[model samples]
Target: MDETENGNLSSDYIAWTIVANVLAKQMNMAGPSAAYNGQAPLSEAQMKRIHDYFFGRLHGGFQIAELAATLGMSRTSFFKRFGRTARVTPNQYLQILRVEKAKILLRNENLTLIEIAFACGYADQSHLARFFKRYVRMSPGRYRSKMREEDVA
Candidate 1:
């Protein structure tokens, strides 16, 4: 709740914000009808193209600026559009993608952590470890050991 400095309740700001966001989402789902009333949202095909372009180059150190250029949008615009369509920003999507790929690579004992890091588009083992801790809640070595245990079972 939002209120004056004196502390009496003035507005349910959080509830209204949630309602506004939900209504905006519903309007976005309404598509062309909503577009005719306001600005046209990206079409399904446009969104697919964006996803395809991003995934196709995901392994080659793709940048938000590069993706924005491919979509003919500014960085902020592309970030908003991609977030609305994918429910995650480009960097989040890329990190998740890389982490998923790293999981698969982890099964290969022949690869070192540094090698896996490079393969997964991370700068180094430390970079991979940081994201693993953030996303997977464990270090890469721990994740690999857990996978190993699961496999043996």
Candidate 2:
């Protein structure tokens, strides 16, 4: 009922929506033959480890080569395996992850653009603005304003 409560509920909804959509996409890709391929599919543990490593690098700053080493894989082999499992190149996946984090931060409206940029692993607000425009089709300020307007309505 209060503003804070409403904001928390909206944030929860947004997070759940993102997770649901991702799960739906994965579910749609599941197939009998896809599981029975000659090469063993990644175990759930392996998938979780890979996902955690990738997500951590995006959410928390970590060098790509270091992450690869932590996974006990060479950079080339790690990238190849990650791409095969995630269906996107490592760089592309990182970009998407960063953009998604930026979207969540945009909704907060308390943090300055520069703060959000660095929090999302961008070099600066300008860097974030460029990628935000490329991926979201609008500047971060505009995106936040629009979302607030929609919330008001």
Candidate 3:
């Protein structure tokens, strides 16, 4: 291979190797010694616990206060820690999660907007429409219509 081609191949191999290492570490398939040692160390176990707690339970009627208590932290402290770890406030994160689920329901077309709203944890269709507009920049109905048009195209 030419010098440029050889360099590109080497770079691609290095990138793939790093990705594989990270995946292995995340799955805990690699031995303890294979874990990443990086700057600004925090407990990976603690972070994993937090991630599971937030994502797994939050959608099923788990309240913020209860989450904070589960983490053995005051509500304020928990909010700060959750924000620091997640890079968004807890409520913002929950809203995003709920909205994403709502988008899936919108795609189904069989569910009424009110049903989808309730399924995704909103109080009603109006509440869903408000937050959906804020993040998605369109009403759910309009968004679904656009998706249908795109599918036909």
Candidate 4:
């Protein structure tokens, strides 16, 4: 609910989508004939390529069509496959990546939230906070504080 209210899901999920599944495998659970495995969303190699590209361009936002072209996939194919594999839209995946990046960046006491936001490709600090809270369930500042406390402990 919060994700939809905030207009997004967490970026951490994106960082971990982490698979390729078997297509020909038979399911023996339902009398051995209920169904066969569905095709995997993308190959491990393809996911790695997408992750690399997204990481490389993290600081600069991108368009879905542009990303599709970069992957040599049609927009529809890319969207469908990514959605199937990651269980979230490409834009949502990007947001998860951004939030995860922000989490790491928050460890640095010197840089402000605004810097972290831009570093993670958000429009501003508030943008980072909104998504961060939605996905992480805490404000960035509080998260940073908690992390710092953990470090001290």
Identify the candidate with maximal lDDT. Answer: 4
lDDT of 2 by residue, 1-118 (tens): 2347437877787899999999988977885454343233445776687667767787555566886777665666666666667778767777878988999999997899999999
**Candidate 2 vs 4: which has more TM-score:** 4
State every prediction's TM-score relative to the real structure.
Answer: 0.62, 0.60, 0.59, 0.69
Model 4 misplacement above 4 A: 1-39
Top-TM-score structure, candidate number: 4
List the global CA lDDT of all models.
0.78, 0.78, 0.73, 0.79
Write model 3 residue lDDT over 94-134, tens digit each, in one string: 77778888888888878899999888888889999999998
Q: lDDT by residue for model 4 over 1-153, one digit each (tens)?
A: 246654355544443342112222333333342111323477788789888878877777767888778777777778877888889887787788889999999999999999999899888989899999989999999999999999999
Poorest 10 consecutive residues by lDDT, candidate 1:
32-41
Question: Candidate 1: where is the Cα deviation over 4 Å?
Answer: 1-48, 59-77
Worst 10 residues of 4 by lDDT: 18-27
50-71, model 1: which lDDT tens digit per residue? 7676567656767778777876
Cα lDDT of model 1 overall?
0.78
Q: How far is candidate 2 from the true structure (C-alpha RMSD, Å)?
A: 22.4
Selected candidate, larger lDDT, 2 vs 3: 2
